[model samples]
Target: MKNQTKWKISTLISLICLIIPFSIYSLWIYVFNLGTTQAERVSVFKDYFPDFLDGRWSTTIFSIIFSISAVILSSINLKHLKKIWKLINIIILILSGILLFLNLFSMM
Candidate 1:
């Protein structure tokens, strides 16, 4: 049972690392529409993104890299993992909250 738990944790860490890169790639594909035209983009994937979004891919890509690195580091240094995760969560939560607020304000 204990070994299974450890394996689950290890798998989780790997999965988390992959998610960040995958999200960034998805966002990149959304913004650039690389190898895809406007008419094709909508047919391919329009439901995932907000209609209001201006496609700022650079910001999102950097954020993904930073987030993934933070998680990987925390996983390695389990002793400080809680503190690191808290900080990361707070930063992302506040940033997203501010973005959502500003967007709503702009629309109003």
Candidate 2:
């Protein structure tokens, strides 16, 4: 039971690590733009946000998909646990955190 709870909490943390950043980022762009076209949104973020969001919508879509998948799989099947996978999960979580910190409320 303890293990399950720990794993569940860890998984939830991982999900938040992914979702919160992406949500804040997309919302940041949408909020600033309010109702702009694709090109306009890209231009604004490029000028202000200054990241891949400017170069390609494909990049945005890719990040969103991967982040969402990581969130979903956090609570998924635990039967296949392996050391390598755990390390990878940690890396993914850290990357998500970095993205989140970089995007919103960082100023750092």
Candidate 3:
């Protein structure tokens, strides 16, 4: 019982980690689509999430970290979870992989 509970908590944490990057990217796209000019769009985005645009690689770094952690957690819990949870964990794993790939590719 206790072990199963631990896996459940890990699964939830993994799902949350997976969500962070997707939400961030979605907001990024929304911000990117706003404004009439490049500078204007950047200024708007900077106004909201200045750390991401400060040249410190905050977005990329956080995305990669969260995605990787989600992937790890999900993979570890995949075999332990039952039906619906197994499905959710698989989805998390796949999305995390994609997020990790995009972040790594963007860095290159």
Q: Tell me, by TM-score, which candidate is best.
A: 3
Query: Residue by residue across 2-101, what tens digits does model 3's lDDT show?
Result: 9888999999999999998898788778988888898887677667665544654677788899999999999999989898888989999999999999
**Ranking of models by lDDT:** 3, 2, 1
Deviation (Å) of 67 in candidate 2: 2.9
Clashing pairs in 1: none
TM-score of each: 0.33, 0.41, 0.87
Kindly indicate the candidate among 1 and 2 with the higher TM-score: 2
Residue-level lDDT tens digits of model 1 in 24-83: 445656666543677565434444555553354533544455455544543443433355
Error of 3 at 98 (Å): 0.7
What's the C-alpha lDDT at position 85 in model 3? 86
Give the distance in Å from residue 29's predicted Cα in candidate 1 to where it truly belongs.
Answer: 0.2
Per-residue lDDT of candidate 2, residues 1-108 (tens digit) = 667667656666666557645764776666566546766655555565445555545345545555655644653523434465566566665666466345333332
Separately for all candidates shown, the number of backbone clashes (residues 3 or more apart, or on different chains) is 0, 0, 0
- For model 1, the local distance difference test gives 0.48
Instruction: Give Cα distance to truth, residue 15, candidate 2, Å.
Output: 2.4
Q: What is the lDDT of residue 15 in candidate 1?
A: 47
